[model samples]
Target: MSIQVGDTLPDVEIRVVSNGIEEGRTGPLFAGRKVVLFAVPGAFTPTCSNRHLPGYVQHLAQFQARGVEVMCLAVNDAYVMQAWAASQNVPPELLMLADGNGNFTKAMGLELDGNAYGMGLRARRFALYAENGVVKALQVEAPGEFRVSTAEAILEALA
Candidate 1:
């Protein structure tokens, strides 16, 4: 079933670079924290690069101040995620997680069909406020829309 507002996160090893150094076999990234996990269609796509990711990147400090650990998930692999992170000038802290096989995306029930666009599987734009791995607020956008899950909106939820 699709994960909902109160759903606890699945314990999956979503590949992540804990810092710039990269890490181990990977583990559940949100076992004990308040996390703002957002998913995008692809890494480096114009809207995701210009809006989705940067909105989080620029207001990272604001999120931090509110005790939100922001994470970005895309259907690409770790290497691509890392390269894109570097290109976006993301700070060391904002985690870029690779949902390479779309396992987590499917698990969360948010995969999008982009076969016509040649991307195959991807994620819809959405943000969830999770507390200790359970979602508290969920904001999912209709295809091609960006109004509801912006950083400002998530911050409002936090408030």
Candidate 2:
């Protein structure tokens, strides 16, 4: 089942780049804070790179205006995620995390198989509004869909 609204987010390990060095961070970054967590299937994928990510990039100011901290999570490594963020010009304020090995994605129950495309476990496209480490709004897609989970949708929910 998907992580529903009001579910307490699981504690998962994250890789963080500090001064060009990669280190693992545990516990939850969203603890005691409001966050907009988004998951995508893969990095550099069509819809993901094009519409999904850009929507967040474009409306980041609006999200922040409402006191929301937006974060993007993927089942990719820290290196790839950092590169993708740079390539897409995502702002520094937004948290783009790498959930490598699917530990966090699996914990959120949003894991998907992209073996046909040579990609293993990945996260489905979705978005959640979390406050103080607990979910307040949830939007898991309908498998091949990507409408409501966009940043604009999350912004609407936040508003």
Tens digits of per-residue lDDT, candidate 2, 101-144, equal 88888888888988987888999889998888888988888888
Rate residue 135 of model 2 by lDDT. 86
Q: Over the full model, what C-alpha lDDT does candidate 1 score relative to the true structure?
A: 0.85
- How many clashes (backbone N, Cα, C below 3 Å) per candidate? 0, 0
TM-score of 1: 0.93
TM-score of each: 0.93, 0.92
* Candidate 2 clashing pairs, residues 3+ apart or interchain: none
Name the weakest run of 10 consecutive residues (lDDT summed) in model 2: 17-26
Q: Compute the lDDT of residue 130 as modeled in candidate 1.
A: 91
Best by TM-score: 1
